[model samples]
Target: MPRQAKSAAAEVRSLREEIERHNYLYYVLDRPEIPDSEYDAKMRRLQKLEAAHPQLADPASPTQRVGAAPREGFGKVLHSVPMLSLDNAMSREETAEFEARIRRFLNHTGPIAYVAEHKLDGVAVELVYEKGLFVQGSTRGDGTTGEDVTANLRTIRSVPLRLRAARSRGLPERLEIRGEVILSKRGFAQVNAQQVERGEPEFMNPRNATGGSLRQLDSRVTASRPIEMFCHSSASLEGLHVSTHWEFLDLCRGLGLRTDRANRRCASLDEVFAYYEATEAKREELPHEIDGVVVKVDSLELQRRLGERDRSPRWAIAWKFKPRQAATRVLDIWPSVGRTGVITPIAALEPRNIGGVTVSNASLHNMDEVERKDIRIGDEVLVERAGDVIPYVLRSFPEKRTGKERKFHMPSACPRCGGRVRREPGEVYYRCLNVACPTKLEGGIKHFAGKHAMDIDGLGDKLVHQLVETGLVKDLAGLYHLELDALVDLERMGEKSARNLLARIERSKQTTLDRLLNGLSIRHVGEATAKALADHFGDIEKVLAAEPDDLLEIRDVGPEVARAIAEFFAEPRNRQQVRRLLDAGVRPAWQPRRGGKLAGKRFLFTGGLAAMSRHEAQARVERLGGAVATSVSKNVDFVVAGEEAGSKLKKARDLGIEMLSEQRFLDLVGDA
Candidate 1:
């Protein structure tokens, strides 16, 4: 080998060693010695050296954690030991019965030591490690065979690429670690935010996001998401013996794999119930979603004695939390128009308490969703807060339907303005094509004056209704042209109140481009997309002039979104309204914002930002000429992590993206 090649190899080795040490400290021990930025620099140096000298790259190298070639499809991999599902104990009585059955099977009367772990709501997978090196990973498909997802799994930072040699003294030659792949609550929100920004449907929950991300054919796509894993059990092990489940978890942790920190050892069933109740009480506080707790016999010998029963182990049981659902009768189904003119079917239900809150109505989403679920007026239905938020109609109880039940049909005409309603080809929603529809006008005007938009205080629903009904305001532009005399004529509008509202309207004139674009209520153009467009074009006139192809050049703008933006700008009426607003002193401030200290940088925020909301943090970044990204990616310059930062932080570490503490971020932006 040439001297230069030898020198490169040595440097790569040194960098890899340092990077691995930091990974162990951060992921396993939760004690990071160096700041994430310094660690990222080291990892980047290793990656650059390996890229220049391909022969120096190793499969187990920390640098290989991401940036793999995309595969055509996943191949099949059979589990050496089937990944069995668990039996559930839905109530305290069922849990007691489970404990009695286990004792009978083991022929023991004394209390059995049990390990309780939160049952993560995610997809299960098996990770195979050879000689302390991660080699393969597969999803738990059918509990027997699974599709290989090794490349995607490698992108998850919590999963070790190579076990710590210092802690691998008693490690097995080959280990198959069984775990759950999950997206934390924060990560799930970020993924959904990006999806919406790209004009794609949002994921229902974190579990769905995890499953979707893990199945991506492109490893780079998976790497861009914030996916994580928590190793809980072993599918197969060789050259190692552990007597207790708790001991095994400790061993897994020592090998530099992450285990849930909330796992506890209970002395008796009473202790188990206590632990379950405690965890259930704080379920909403967990970073990752969990549906229940798994109780397993701590003693491996006792587990063997109790043996397996078909699919589930007899010695373990899942104690599930109460379902967040209630049965209610659908009073009626009605159509409502949104700012985008899509007609959504909403079901007014008999008020029922679900998860301690009364839900009087739930969105049926669309006509297709209503038909698919066969929801009918006056029929009994099961209502649940999907993902513990957003009331959803799960299904209808057809058996309980009465003779008064009526089938619902989509309205052929707009209910509010009598406009013709049409469903676009290849789409599931019915839209009102009339731009002057009263419902759409009111919705758009209200949204324009919303808190996140122009923030015109005192111009609420009642006032907006009076303005539209009195024929004083026809569109968003009309708000800027409202006179105090006309407002004073409306009901309950005194001289002082009218003056205050006018002051707010005048104050809204000097707003940012993003806010103005968002207030326009263009189809598929949300706050995030609006911000991206404002940053990319820097002016409203430039955005209006850009073609669909030009708009597609910006990140997260798909063909659908590009078309929507172009169509919105192409409408003569829309253009006229924008011009009128501009003429009425509604100037969108677009001063060049790309020359600040943080210019041309991208930031991802996770966890609770103490000093401000996530939106406020994002606004700060934009004000400083930096862009806020919804997901972690190679292009991300830094991750501003606050308290309880979750999977995004882990992903940033894996991809060698710089990370900053909230204080450090404040300092960088000169706010400290």
Candidate 2:
């Protein structure tokens, strides 16, 4: 079956923006609009889809950073080390998988020790002490640079101004301590009572109140807030004698800094899971909020061996507990149309607080889901932030429902354009069939101009929407007809911007056949399938003329995908649009994958290459039927090393994997 993620490049971009917006809301503003589980779902989905199609990965993606940029009122402080986030494991199965992945990456057969600490649901801040005196502190803003909240952090009495004298372990020349600043349950209640007395809006939760209080411009106001800090992990130790995370925590305690007493050392994966269950069972009894337990490889050497991804560390993971549920009355049920014309049912609920955040809506997904759960308007439904990320209607209580409750029926027409809607055979989704539906049309344009498709640089969502609403362009081919005079007059488009957009549109005419196919908005034809089609057929005309059976002959093309392709080209309207594009001089260059020596091999590169860049290496590999992977695994056939190869080189060597020098790698590709 084809993955639900379509036009990998476009969805990748869309998911990135959505995840980043949530990050800003949760991290910077401290106004968490979604549960942590909900946020994790988006991040995990983005990671999976991006991994499948590595070409769509972006450096600015939420998957590439730990947090959002610092709230802009204060000065910025750069950290000596990047504070990467820990990936989450929702169940023991996922936690076990985390360990299994590490074993494969490290090629280890021995037992791995770990440090399990209570994953604090509080604001994470970094404090630096120079020569035993507190020097500076900041929030973990964007991981590298953070807002300078040194004064406000100082106001918290628990944050030591000077390190306490110790015999065994003296203070390092400089120490960077990472900790969680949390407001106590009692403190939160008292603060809310004060807010009520002062006629001010009370905070939503302890975590929010803690973050908002810490970021206050006035240190005196922050000092008044009853908040404390619990030292957790740190990126830098400076001159400390710590070989393991366990030792580091003990050392931190000895230096008069408070650490979570709930921290446990686990010798194996089973032990980690045991602690996790125990911590979760008694989490409510704790003074502050703790959503999960963080498990990290105890051996610093093992951690070094595991390394990290661009966004999070590989040797550690946050094992989050189950989602929190709340009962809320469904006031209304409505259908919302997506860019792809799929209409999803959403339930507007009487707002209720679940896991410290207020949720007013939950997704019903489709009519099938609604029927399965028996959800209806006026029903008191059980809503859960599934994985703490999305508001989900778990089930509806028909027993508690009044006779006034109504069954929901999907509308015959689209809510956006009031156009005819239909459900295809054996599909769960209902789609708007009208090609000119504003929502669907704009979505198609977005996919067409996406980086994965025609690679039009200056065409953004606003510009695309403007182009559609102004009647400047109705279809993909109409984009080619846009003039600078009209474009310049659109809101926010200067003369320079108009010219740039026109140039980008002109440049898009010269894309590859595979990208052109992906941009066409065919039902299930995404980047991978499009590339396979282009590589197999070698021409746009061949693909257009191919039968469903012919499409099935290509690798990875299933019957459904092949049928979708055949059906797409069979449409007279689609054929005419292709003709219009051709007449507009849009020539998609075709290239066939060469069947050669490198055909079945997978190559991974480490260190620097003198002859060419890593990207050039990938292109050379892919030109043949070979593949390029980002990590060292049993799957990788060759490990190419150059000047100063890092841990991957060591890992590959330890696995007795074949290594090729820069010259040898070049010769292999050159010969092929």
Winner by TM-score:
1
lDDT of 1 by residue, 1-672 (tens): 999899999998888888888887887778899998799779767866787789986887887777477789999999999889999999989999998888676678987899999999999999999988899999999999999999999888888988764354666889999999999888888886666444344565788889999999988778878888899999777878789999999989888898989999999999999999999999877888898999999999898788788988888899988888899999999998876677878999999988778999988877778888999999999998745445889999999976889999888999888899998877767889787997788888988998777888887878887898888998888888789889898899999999999999999999988899988888778787888787766667766666566676576786877898899899999998889989998878765564555655668888888887786577577667766767776656789899999998998999998888988888777761
Q: List the residue pairs that clash in candidate 1.
A: none
lDDT of each: 0.84, 0.79
Number of colliding residue pairs in each model: 0, 7
Model 2 TM-score, all chains together = 0.44
Global Cα RMSD, each model: 11.5, 22.7
- Report model 1's TM-score to 2 decimal places: 0.75
Looking at model 2, the pairs that clash are: 37-387, 37-388, 37-389, 38-388, 38-389, 38-390, 39-389
Candidate 1 residue runs with Cα over 4 Å from true position? 1-74, 151-157, 160-172, 184-213, 216-227, 239-241, 436-438, 441-472, 488-501, 517-535, 545-581, 586-672
